[model samples]
Target: MSSADSTDAPIYAGLVEEQGDVLAEVRRVAEEVLRDADRAIDFGGVRSSAAYR
Candidate 1:
């Protein structure tokens, strides 16, 4: 198979979670939380974990 064909399959192919709805929830949290602070974390602005709370 070509490299392009492999891209058609899931990265977690054959895993049980890959076939369920759990990944959707994971992506949601990642986008909401991680993506939000990604910039500050990169610039060293977030100094403490408590800042998140």
Candidate 2:
């Protein structure tokens, strides 16, 4: 089973949470990713030069 599958599973996130410093750093990184995703430009439908569609 995966870490998130059950509480008995060995989870890296659990280890991080047990350590305050690592968990805080992880939270900071996650927040930055969320912020970047919010501000990100959507070029999804745009065709690239090499892509013929």
User: Top model by lDDT, which number?
Assistant: 2
Candidates' TM-scores? 0.31, 0.39
**Cα lDDT tens digits for candidate 1, 1-53:** 89977986665565545566667779898898977787556745455655787
Model 2, span 1-53: residue lDDT tens? 77557775447556756865675788999999988997796566465733865
Q: At residue 46, give the lDDT of candidate 2.
A: 63
Model 2: what TM-score?
Answer: 0.39
Which run of 10 residues does model 2 get worst, by summed lDDT? 41-50
What's model 1's TM-score? 0.31
Give per-residue lDDT, candidate 1, residue 19.
65
